[model samples]
Target: MVERKTIFSYLPHLILLIGIAVVAFPVYVAFVASTWDPATISNGQMPLRPGPHFLENYYQTIFVGTSRTTREPVGGMMFNSLVMALTIAIGKIAISIISAFAIVYFRFPFRMTAFWVIFVTLMLPVEVRIYPTYKIVSDLGLLDSYAGLTIPLIASATATLLFRQFFMTVPDELVEASKIDGAGPMQFFRDTLLPLSITSIAALFVIQFIYGWNQYLWPLLITTRDSMQTIVIGIKKMIVTQDALTEWQIAMATAVLAMLPPVLVVILMQRLFVKGLVETEK
Candidate 1:
């Protein structure tokens, strides 16, 4: 007789299957909606079928045919999103690595207190601090600037803390051996520490990249000019316009477009990220 699976093993798979469906349903609906016409969407049509207008909608959304101020093309929007996300990711890595190295390897007075101050920012999310952050951005003459948008979120306390924790696992003998061979702090970090922490760094890179890519509310609040608008802002602008009704098809299309980068990044890096986690256990 065939053996039946136990509830314990089967239950987790059931939950995961449900979760996957829940997450994928919206994306599938959006794709289907993007292919349909605005009239069909407005008329409460169900099971939206792919129409011939799919290419037309995509073309109009992505490329410019007329005026510059009429709403950004999908290409420009995607480019802006790519640049911002990459900038944030690179900045986060540079800043966090230094911060992690300092906290993990160096000893100084009131160091714990300093780390805590940064950590506390995590508790009060960007939402809570928007008023003050906006003011600070304005006062610094950085409003609508890439520096203002990117710099505020450049350093992540969470990345530093996690890296520090992982770094603690590295053998002190390695540092001592390097020092005995006449390596300095910078050399040791670059030649020894970083090489050993690739997994942790890869893991952090994926996480931070996603976090930066998905940032919407902060970008919306900060960027005023159309030129400064990122993909998320462009998507929002397409959905609700002061002059006309919401264009549901284009909005969904824009969303689907915006999602590609992060999704592709994760898919490409999933192996490294997972391998990093596996190595972390050892």
Candidate 2:
């Protein structure tokens, strides 16, 4: 209480409150809208108050979906999203950590050259290489499969860079000590590096999970099969009519449902995520 006496101290809280409102307001509106039917919202006179059909609307959206479009269950879409998010999160961590370790610990021919080549990928967003990615996946016959859905998006230049930089900050004494104890690189990596990297790994998992969950474009592009469609893409199908006929209530419900897992992940890993950001930079 004493620390918060000054107006300066309250300024940060005020700013944060404003930021929270800015972010939460849309979600709140969606929740409100999801509780109402089309006729109630279509007149452009929707109430901020909760409507009576909230449970029914959500039940239909999750289990039955819309009769007008898609009609695929939201439960299935959620499951697909979960699988893709987990796959991408785990895959990126595995790929990035190994790449980071090799780049940091070993001395080989064109080592820095390889690092630079990997780093250069950060300059090229997926949109730029979408065609090439599609071609490769198609040639490999992975389209519409889980591998096709996730493998293409699993590469993360930023994650590799973070791990590599963090690895550099690790004391060389640990490496020497391990070698003196007759521990090989793999042994040291498994025993020491992984233990030390729990925070970083948790933080990356939180981030990459959200990234994978919110992926609309790549999933939409690759997954032609309704059964493989992720929640984010499934939401788009609700608006197929694009007018008042578009079931805003179900769409809003779907949006709210889609937000849950990532929100829960961030909330649970909040401390580790912040710590990882600060530590990895140092």
Candidate 3:
């Protein structure tokens, strides 16, 4: 038998429900607005209830796009976003893990100094370094390319630190046992270390993917061609005009679509992310 809850016990649940509604109200309104005609939303009298044009609005946003301000389809933009996001995530993980492995396993002079220098980068915001980074990317002839979009953002100090901390937790006994079995350091790392690092890699991948996908300023400045535009950056072009003729329905639909990938990533990987975080901290 279950014990009945008193009114005071329900207070916390009530508060949480209220909080969820407060945050979700704007998204609900956007979803509602996306189902209305441009004229309906343009009048600012859009209904609270679901309108009949939801499917058409989404279809146009994905395939046809809001062409008044931008001609590129949202489908292409989403593809570009996915590419950038995955590239950043993979690049960060690859480099960070290697750097951490080198730092933890090898005893080189000035190793701590090198580690500190890399760690110091965490304090610097991307905005602070954008001008120099832009100049370098321009000089390298990488502008308007995927490399320009993802490379400059791939050096992740947080991921490196996380991996370094995790590496320190691996037992010295494992190294001894592997050596006794005639396994080289590289061979041991390939089999033992990588397997143990899976949860951390998954968690970091999610973080870096979100970071790359949501990048607006850098992509906006670097990408001159419409074909290179990311969904986050391209959405701005859709709202350039404040007039009633602007496609609010299409814009709202696109906004909803833009939010789906990151949300789904977190929801799908919730268990892995939690485990990775907890273990990493330990």
* RMSD vs true structure, all candidates: 3.9, 2.9, 2.5
Clashes per model (N, Cα, C within 3 A) = 0, 0, 0
Off by over 4 Å in 2: 1-19, 275-282
How do these models rank on TM-score, best leading? 3, 2, 1
TM-score of each: 0.85, 0.90, 0.93
Clashing pairs in model 2, backbone N/Cα/C closer than 3 A: none
Give per-residue CA lDDT, model 1, range 217-281, as digits (tens).
Answer: 88888888877778787876765445247777778888888898788877899886665445434
Judging by lDDT against the true structure, name the best candidate.
2
The sequence of per-residue lDDT tens digits that candidate 3 reaches over residues 1-282 is: 275777678888999999999999999998998899888888789889989998888889899888678977899999999999999989999999999998999899999998998889888877888888889999999999999999888887888889999889899998889899999879988988999988788888877777788998899889999999999988888886567557888888888889999878878988866665565444
lDDT of each: 0.78, 0.89, 0.87
lDDT of 1 at 80: 70
Return whichever of 2 and 3 wins on lDDT.
2
lDDT per residue, candidate 2, 76-129, as tens digits?
A: 999999999999999999999999999999999999998999889888888988
> Candidate 2 local accuracy as lDDT?
0.89
Candidates 1 and 2 compared: the better one by TM-score is 2
TM-score of 2: 0.90
